[model samples]
Target: MPLLAADNLSLERGGRQLFRDLSFKVFPGQLVQIEGANGAGKTSLIRILAGLSRYGYEGRVSRSGAMLYLGHHSAVKALLTPRENLAWHVSGEADFSDRDIEHALARVGLYGYEDVPSHALSAGQHRRVNLARLYLSQSPLWILDEPYTAIDVTGVGELETLFAQHARAGGAVLLTSHQAMAVDYPVSRLDLTAGIAS
Candidate 1:
């Protein structure tokens, strides 16, 4: 079974159809990239797949396992430390220990900054704090919307390695990134702009 399947998916916003009859699937050990020009509804499509969409759409979305989502904006609490934010964001079947959380933080290069409030961190650091949750997730499907925002070169490389590792381990990732990936695994792209009506 596919990790995620979208059958005849159609979404409308402000009475205009953003995408129509779009069908796709993310299988195990695969990386599916969602791409589009601005206003092509990339974020909307990601939200629908992540099950966080507010607007109704026509389609059937099937998931074989749990999904983790990272949005374009960092969801960290300004007043909370990175440790606290990661603790609140970690979920799913796997339980994360404090050591696991610290390891995740270190993986994201936040070694000495774990206890610092997120508001004090730079924009990229804040993003890293939010992304640390990915290390603790065991979800088979990851829905990421513009996950590269505010990340530096090193962080981007680390994330690409992380995604590649996930795919190699039979997990799947669905993400939107304007920057071309350098992952070792194969990546298939779904371009929303190709089907959108101009």
Candidate 2:
């Protein structure tokens, strides 16, 4: 069964129609990328699918299991440390032990900075803190928006490997990224510009 499905989605912003009658399904073990130009409503579409913007559009979104959504913003609190952010995530994830949180931070290259204030970290480091959630998440579906924004080349490669691993493990990932993936796994594309999934 599909992890998530969108039916007849349509959106209009600022008197401009971004998309109309858009629909797609994200199934288990699939890595899907939402593709579009800057003003093509990629983020809008992702937000709709993730159930973050429920009232503004016309569509029905259904999910089969728990999901993890990482939006374009880092969403890290400036006063909190990396460890604290993961320990008390806004997504309401289950309580994880200190060891697991630190390990996840380490995987995303925030090992020693786990206790450092988020205000002192660079943009990329803040992004890493958000990426750490991917490692700790047990959700079957991951919906990420612009996940590669501040990551380094090596970090990007690591994320690709992680995505591939997730798909191989019967999990699904739906993300919006301008950088083309260079992984060994097959990536399905949902081009918002063309209103088609391929």
Candidate 3:
């Protein structure tokens, strides 16, 4: 079975029909991109898949495993250091040790900034710190929205590598990004403007 499946999905906002009758499946090792113009309900669709919303939607959305979600916001505490933040972020789902937190930070190029408050980091750095959750996460499915925001070219390369590694390891990623992707893995795109993709 696909890691996630959405059948005949629909949603509305402010009485405006954002999308309708959309369907798609995300399988293990697949990188699925959700594409659309502004106000095309891309973020709304992702929220439903993440189980964060069900209003004004009709659909059977199902998933078989754990899912990690990173929305538009970085979702980090400004006062907390990278190490403290990561430890706090994943503490609910996984028992991440200090070594694990440090390792994830290092992978995201935040090694020396581990103890510095997030507010001190640049926007890109803040985004990278949040992305370290990808390394710490063991979820089979990842739902990310605008994850590349504020990321530099080097950071983008690193993230693309991480995405490829995740897919090669039989994990799946569903994401929305305006920036072009340079991943080596085959990508399946669901363009909301064009309706559901087969």
Candidate 4:
């Protein structure tokens, strides 16, 4: 069975029909992209899928294992040092530890700044901290919104590598990004403007 399946989904906001008749399924090790212009309801769709909304969806979305949702805003605490922030997340439910945090940061070029407060870090650096969860999540499904924002070229490259590894390991991913992906992996896109992709 597919890891996740959504059938005839729909969502609305402020009485406006954000989207309708959406459907898709994700299998283990598959990478899916949700594409749409601004205001086309990509984020709303994710919110529905993540169960962040109490109601409004028209269809069922079933999944196995767990799913992690990462939004545009960094979940990092600005007042806390990078190590402290990362540790808290790890302890609070993330599947990584200090070593994993350090390794992830290093891979994203944030080495040597582990002890500094997130507020002291540049926007891009702060963004990197939020991304460290990608390595820490161990969840079978990742629902990320514009994860490439503020990340440098190398960081994006690392994300491509991460995606490859995750899919190979039978984890699934669903993401939305304006930029194109660099990996050779086959991606099935759901384009909202066209009213849900095939």
Candidate maximizing lDDT: 2
Ranking by TM-score: 2, 3, 1, 4
Q: Where's the lowest-lDDT run of ten residues in candidate 2? A: 88-97
For model 4, the superposed segments whose C-alpha errors exceed 4 Å read 93-97
Give TM-scores for every candidate, taking all chains together and pairing residue i with residue i. 0.94, 0.96, 0.95, 0.92
lDDT score, candidate 3: 0.89
Specify the highest-TM-score model's number: 2
Q: Estimate, for each residue in 17-113, the C-alpha lDDT of model 4 and write its tens digit.
A: 8788778888898888888889998878887777786666788888878888888778888999877776776676655656888986776777899
Q: Which stretches of candidate 3 lie over 4 Å from their true place?
A: none
lDDT of 3 at 146: 92
Per-residue lDDT tens digits of candidate 3, residues 45-154?
A: 99999999857588889999999999888888999998988899899887988999999999999989999988898888888888999998999999999998998888
Please, what are the lDDT tens digits per residue for candidate 1 over residues 16-106? 8889999988899998888888888899998888888999999988889888889999999999999998988884446788899999999
Assess each prediction's global lDDT (C-alpha) against the native: 0.89, 0.92, 0.89, 0.82
